[model samples]
Target: MTEIYQKLENIVKKEFISNSLIVRHAYSRVVDPVLQGIPDIVIRPKDAKEISEILKVANEENIPVIPRGGGDDEFGGSKPIGDGGIVLDMKRMDNVLKLDEDNLIVTVEAGISWGKLDEYLCHYGLYTGCMGPGSGMTASVGGGISHQSVGGGGCAKYGACTNQLVSLEVVLPNGDIIETGSQANKFSKIPFNRFGNGPDLAGLFCGDNGIMGVKTKVSLQVFPRPPFAAYKTFLLPRKDRQVSSQIMLDVRRKGIDVYDLMYIMDLIMRVGCDQGMFPMWEQLKKKRGIIFYTVEANSEAELQEKVKQLDTIILDNKCEALGPEISDGNIAKWHYVEQGHWQFYHNLWGMVPALEPLSCECFVPANMYPTILDDIDQWDMEHAKDMEIFTKVTGMRPITGSGPIFLIDGNNVELTCGFTSFPSYYNGENHEGWDELNLKLWKSLMGMLTTKWGVQWYMMGEMASRIMAQLDAYLPDYYKTLKAIKKVLDPKNILSRGKFEFWGDGNK
Candidate 1:
């Protein structure tokens, strides 16, 4: 056994530290099929103390330690980048520490799945406000918070995972255990507050993507479940993207208690049609946009009033109601495929045959949606013709794009827009060749979006380091401060090396 393995074994039990080839291989694999790096060892720590000890040893030896929770991120965040090191799997630490119903707060170990937590909270008629990712069934609480995922039930109302986060118990790279937010207070029994009479230290780790530290536990604010829910669907003219975007803005501006508002673009409709997923695709073939919205209220009267308000806004935007047939069917299918027992693995593993999907989640200005969609369409057309990939003979098409924008804050429409791209590749027989082309296309598209629209990548993983580096150049002082923090917190840079690459050395 290697010296590092010997040291890790001392920190955890021998059963917890495995250097076996099979185990290491399994640990190396992630949701992204294109990116995989086998770690030297896979270590499962049962608690933060064990993680702290492991970090200390890793720091001393200058070995990279990548903390992984669920390994379900579509972006290559959890996968090792530099020379392989240790994969610190936190699944063994799964626990629901406390449920402070009085303050409407829940404290859970980072490794607990969001689905599990939501299930447990349902018994109490309470739920987290944050919109979990489609993979919430297996996606851990720490994973969602670290990545800042935005989608599920709370998209229109409470925003992303970061919004629901109240506090965090993190293990810094130097192996120091620190609690951020109100949890740091001596007399605090519940971490219901976020600011904590300080400069929002908890916010620092919210979207840091595990680059800052390993989140061992998290405290999130919860809300009582709404008693009533309703859904609606609107069909917008194919040529007018602004109408749908405006309608979404109006919903937030009017302070509608919207649970989820999803805008499905034409390209997505076509893809769904191609996959035979949407039977109503024929009717929407000429339509440019379809919107599905879910509103919630404490009473049926309130729900009806909200729906009436939504209808007025829809008609004002020159959108036609597609009736409940489309909306209810889509919502039912969404719940069945996502929240139900169907095991929604299609997000990571491409469901459509011979096609590999890659999504670039971003937060852009609300007003830029139309222009961005236009640009993407133009790019798709040009690239499709040039690459000879979009042909009837090949049964392959251009990179079809769709975005569902969510409001981060109802008060400020400018700050509300969260847009994400769903792009795919038709691999056919040559998987390797197509995968290479897909990666190249994906990077090019990302570069265009970042350069032209100033879109911020939602999942700041290794793939996003270059973009972060460029963004850092625009704010050298801020990045310098971050680098300094990294130096102090992780002197040896053992935790998530090559992530948020602003340090002088690539690994550091």
Candidate 2:
């Protein structure tokens, strides 16, 4: 065996990676699967110590390393970004370090799936305040933190996933297992006002996308899972941007937590995930539509009240209906049976580029989701005629973006959107002009959004400038300090190789 192979075997199980193409496909990314030469071996580390050893070996041999959890970022984050490297699958490292139900906080390994976390916690009548749709399968706590994921829920009530992070247990490339915040007791007593003592160490790696170092364990804030549940899914018909905005605004006016969400159907995708559809990409090439709806409430009573209000709004506002699907009324229960929300999204679309920009989420203050859509709708109408731009507006009531506890009362009001734009972009049927069209549309919309809209979409994906653009607004000096820390911490750039650069190029 090669020196690299020998080193990998010394640390973790070797069967983590197999030579078969089938294995490669399972481990690969949605966009560029065959990265760097498909890592010679995959390793599974059980704890921070083992992770440290794996990183040390990779650094010594100068091999690439990709630390993956939940296996969700099929585009690039999880798949091999380099060759002959080791893919650290932390899926087996799932151990809930601490579940302080009283304080509403839980510490978990990066490998724990979001759904699993939600399900386990739900049993105790408590749920993660940072629950996303994927909180139900493949979404990992670490991965969500990396992307700063703002799933359909909690986003309106608990802040983004990163906001729930109270502490972190990270492993740097040099084999140092450092604990950033107080394990449990210590962190709880900290000013709670200053985030953490001194420099706020936990903030550095929260959304670094696994570039700075490997996130082995995470500490997150939890919430009452709510004994009663409701999962009402509404279907908006056609492209009535004005009415959609009005409905969302109305919900907030009446005090409802909308947990924002959005979806647009440009023919190909809807057929796949829609109830009775098979997603035969070849036949369903003519279905251009939109689904503007909301999940309603976090409780059964709240859900029913919201349903009545929604009926009034739809009727009064004059919007068409796709259909009124019954609210499951048991969201936490459904979350478990469904595996996870990544399973939710994955089940919806069948045949598209695995890397198809799943969804781009960001916040421009509260009550802005609708306003942003209003702006985009106006722009689309004026600029393009050959194209038909549809709109689906979903809002989170009792918006989580609020202060103190992202909770909703009569006075507080805010809204956010899941904002999706997968218009006319598919792999097989319209592979000709669809690529250019999709690229043009995505770029145009995003470019306008960042510049004209004047607000940042934090989880839109990793664009050096766009991601960096968030530096000053929400977190000042965060990037500069993070880069400097990466230099001092790793200096070898062998940890999460593609996440952030440390020291110099080719350091390891």
Candidate 3:
């Protein structure tokens, strides 16, 4: 074994550290349809101190380190940008530390999956307000926080998962351990609030995409499950995008506290139904776009009032209501009552055999999404030639459009926008130049989305993060300030090196 491997093995058990090719290959990519990096070693540290020790070795050796959670991100966030780095697999640290019912905060090992955490919380009649990304079934809490994730459920009321953060135990790139929020006061007994104690240092790690630090522990506010709830689904009239946007605007203007509000475009409905993916909507006559809402209240009377107001807004927008049963297309009910949040978000992915998604999930203003969707249709047409490459191999071109548009805080909505295409290696044949074409066309789409629509992306993994920098999206002063902070925190740029071009610039 090499000297660096020996040092890491000293920090963690031998079984948890592996430099084997099989193990390194497994940690190389996430959910995306690309191989991001083959790490030199993959190590699972059980706590902040172990992570600190492992990072210390990496800093001393000037080796890159990437912290990986559940590896569910569609972007290549968890994987290194290139070969030869340490993949800090945090999965072994999964554990619930505390549940302070009085403070309504739950502290957990950052590597714990949202599914596991929610299952634990459910036993106590509480849940993380934003159930986390749609992949919450396996997506880690740390990954959600790192991406400012949303779309699992309750985002309309709770916003992104990061909004519920109370504190964090993060290991800086240089192997220094620190606590944020109230815990920053060493005398504090338990984690309480996220603001105040300093300038919300916890915010730096949240959505940092593992670039700022490795989140070892997380404290998030939990909520009691509201007693009274109502859910409904509606099929929109013509001009679905505009109508859906209007419905959300009216819902916000009316000040209705909806647990979830979502718009599924016509393309997804038509395609999904054809593929037998959305059985709930298979009975619809028009196969048009659909909008749904779920509301929660402490009292039956209040619940009825919110439902009535929301129903009026939906009907006034010329939407036809589906029956009240799940079999009758009430996806809203399944999504809210049956915990379908984990299963329902990725309706477009793998809709066809061998198809995978190359998408961007981000936030856009409610009013601006309709125009952006229109532009996406235009974008698809513009790239017809490039798409022909896929058509030639698979007998059909890629499907490009937004998947689900969800209403979050304010007038903003979360949009999973992009296309699904077959990877180059399909059915054991390596289609030459397929990967290059995929990157070219994908980057072009990213450029259009960033420059034209100005959408704020949350999943800034290897692809989107580098594209943002390559596109010169950040203002000079803004980029400079970020670099300065990074330099001070990580002088050697040891953690998540090459992200946003934040290589070893400290020495410069």
Per-residue lDDT value at 238 in model 1: 51
lDDT of 3 by residue, 1-508 (tens): 3988998998997999999989999999887776468889999998999999988899899889999988988878798887888999988888999999998999999999999999999999999989999999888999999999998999999999999999999999998999998999999999999998769899888888999999999999999999899999999999999999999999999999999999999998999998999898876788999999999999999999998999999999889999999999999999988899998765557788888888888889999999999998999999999999889878978999988899998999998988888788988998988877877878888899999888898889877777888888988899899999999999988898888886531211
lDDT: the better of candidates 1 and 2: 1
Query: Poorest 10 consecutive residues of model 1 by lDDT?
Result: 412-421
Collision count for each candidate, in order:
1, 23, 0
Top candidate (TM-score): 3
Model 3: lDDT of residue 164: 95
Candidates in order have lDDT scores of 0.71, 0.53, 0.89
Which residue pairs overlap in candidate 3's backbone? none
List of clashing residue pairs for candidate 1: 238-288
- Tens digits of per-residue lDDT for model 1, 398-468: 45565444455452221112112222333333333645655677677777777777776777767666555
Ten residues in sequence with the least summed lDDT for candidate 2 = 396-405
Which ranges of candidate 1 are over 4 A from the true structure?
279-288, 325-349, 389-395, 411-436, 470-473, 504-508
Task: Write the residue-wise lDDT of candidate 2 on 276-327 in tens digits.
Answer: 4332222333343332334334568877776676557655765434323223
In model 1, the Cα lDDT at residue 244 comes to 72
Superior by TM-score: candidate 2 or candidate 3: 3
